[model samples]
Target: MGLVELAFSDWIGTITLNNPKKLNALSEELIKDFCDALEELKRQSVRVVILRAPAGSKIFSAGHDMRELPLDGRDPLTYTDPLRLAVRTIEYFPAPIIAMVEGSVWGGACELVLSCDIIIAAEDVTFAITPAKIGVPYNISGVQNLIITGGTHICKEMLFAAQPFPVKRLVDAEIVNRAVPIDQLETVAQTLAEQISKNSPLVISLLKEEIRLLSTSHNLSPETFERVQSMRRSVYDSDDYQEGIKAFFEKRPPIFKGK
Candidate 1:
């Protein structure tokens, strides 16, 4: 069976991450399937798309499949990486995409949720960007998404602490549109999707594109961009980076030395 599944009805398309055993880790194959599913749903003229994990799963996603990560010094989240492509696809999708978040959203998955047009999370939901824990240097686009949603203060705290922020805090930070009881999450998300699907598809599509463009309007100079990239490169090339990933697999705390 595919790691991702898509179902459509009444102009609303639902995509469920189906790898409960792996906590829906965004493996390369799964990401490709997800992108393909989005493309198919767009072709069907679905007015709204809902992304979620399979029901009854405790983790919405544990983020990227760490086992797939490279220890050979390549950037895992480079622009052309599968995870980056998946986020880009969601961001530019012609129709609105809503993230129906439950359980915990971690690392790259948090960026994925941030890229969605709207996010409705359950009360039990917790969002964490965990690259700091693994010494991974998060990409600029991902960080921008967080800043756009939650402002610089919230984004800085999330990235530096590498801790989960509860749904209520996210709602306050404007990252989450609403936080509903766990039992009511599905119903609320479905109702919202139905309402969105009733709107004119063309208008919705144009509005989505306008908002995406406007949000990304700020441009960084070439030299500044290269400087940021260089800083990130230094982190990924450091001994701390190796120790972080090693400690993760060894099930221990990483002791990072500023070397």
Candidate 2:
């Protein structure tokens, strides 16, 4: 079926990214389905939400649908970007949204996972923040999201290096709550979700919002905001950016010219 699947049992809601053919890429349609699932779960008063992929998924998500990315002349990850919308939806969800990760998470998908209240991952899962690899100028808000979850130094490593890091190590960094063996991932995530569902939903919701507010309260002055935007604009407008996208489709290493 659907690119995203929703299920509810015992007050715990499950939202599965079901587009395995595309590695659950966050296309506009997929994000729309995901948000709708979250909304319906909210309406049904599901006490806790588990956002995941199907069991044993090899790639939890391939991140943003590169095909949907705008070419130069427009900001790619704008306010209304599907990836941004999905991250915001999870951040503002009344219930605690837990990311139950079982495979490699890349690019915008990692941002979505960080927006979740708790992250439980399989030991073999790896996360890569890859805008740099493709020469995309990542947005400031997205970068801040990564900093909040992973701290600045680690975020720098992830973004600059454009490489995947083991979920097991991220657990020690507090990015992930637990990194259990793949065999134990389902049990661990389910137990955590059920435990959260057992809590006072009202109080938990209040706390979730409060924590979300405080954690994401980074305020940038107008001048600072403009500077960040200008830098991102320059990157996206450069020849290197176009070359990167082209190379991706051609399945070859991009030959970036420092334009």
Candidate 3:
């Protein structure tokens, strides 16, 4: 079976992550398949695309496939990174994308869902951004994605603590549109997509582009930009960053010395 599967109903398209064995981790291959699926949906002019997993999944996605991460001193989330590509594809996709989230989302997967236009989640679902836990310094754009949803305070909390938060917290913060029973997840997403499909797709597409441009709009001095890059570079080049990946492979907690 394909790692990513596409199904359609009228003007709506659904992309299901089929690699439950890997907890649907956003590996390089899976991301490639996902991007291909989106391209196919775009060709079909799907008015709304639903990104989801199969029913009753206890862990929607484990986020970035750490095994694919480089052990050498190199940036893992570069422009050509798989997770980065997936997030950009979703954000720039003309159609309104809906994240049908069930179970728990972790690390880069949390950023992926937030990239979608609408998110319908299960009540028991959880969300967490865990770069800190693994000693990874998240990319600036991904950090901005969290701040866009709930401001700097929420962004700091999730990134610093790296703990799982119940779905209600996200709903209260307006990050998630709704948290319904597990059984209602599909129904809610379908209804929402149907409503979206009935509207003017052209207008929606324009608005989506406008929102993307506006939200990401910011003026930064060249020095400030270079400083940020240097800071991230310091971490990725440190021994702690290397230890983080090593610990994951060893199934042990990383012994970080803040190098």
Question: Each candidate: what lDDT?
Answer: 0.89, 0.91, 0.91
TM-score for candidate 3: 0.97
Provide the lDDT at 223 for model 2: 100
Candidate 1 residue-wise lDDT, 1-259, digit = tens? 2989999999999999998888898899889989999999989999999999988778999998988877888876798877789889998899999999887999889988888999999998899899988888888878888888789999999999999999899898777999999899999999999999988989999999999889889998999999999998898888998898899899999999965
Question: What TM-score does candidate 2 reach?
Answer: 0.98
Tell me model 3's lDDT, rounded to 2 decimals. Answer: 0.91
Please write out the lDDT profile of model 3 over residues 165-203, one tens digit for every residue: 888998998989999998888999999999999999999
Rate residue 18 of model 3 by lDDT. Answer: 86
Clashes of 2: 0
Candidate 1 scores a C-alpha RMSD against the true structure in Å of: 1.0
Kindly report which residue pairs in candidate 3 clash with one another.
none
What are the runs in model 1 whose C-alpha is more than 4 Å off?
none
Quote the positional error of residue 95 for candidate 1 in Å.
0.5
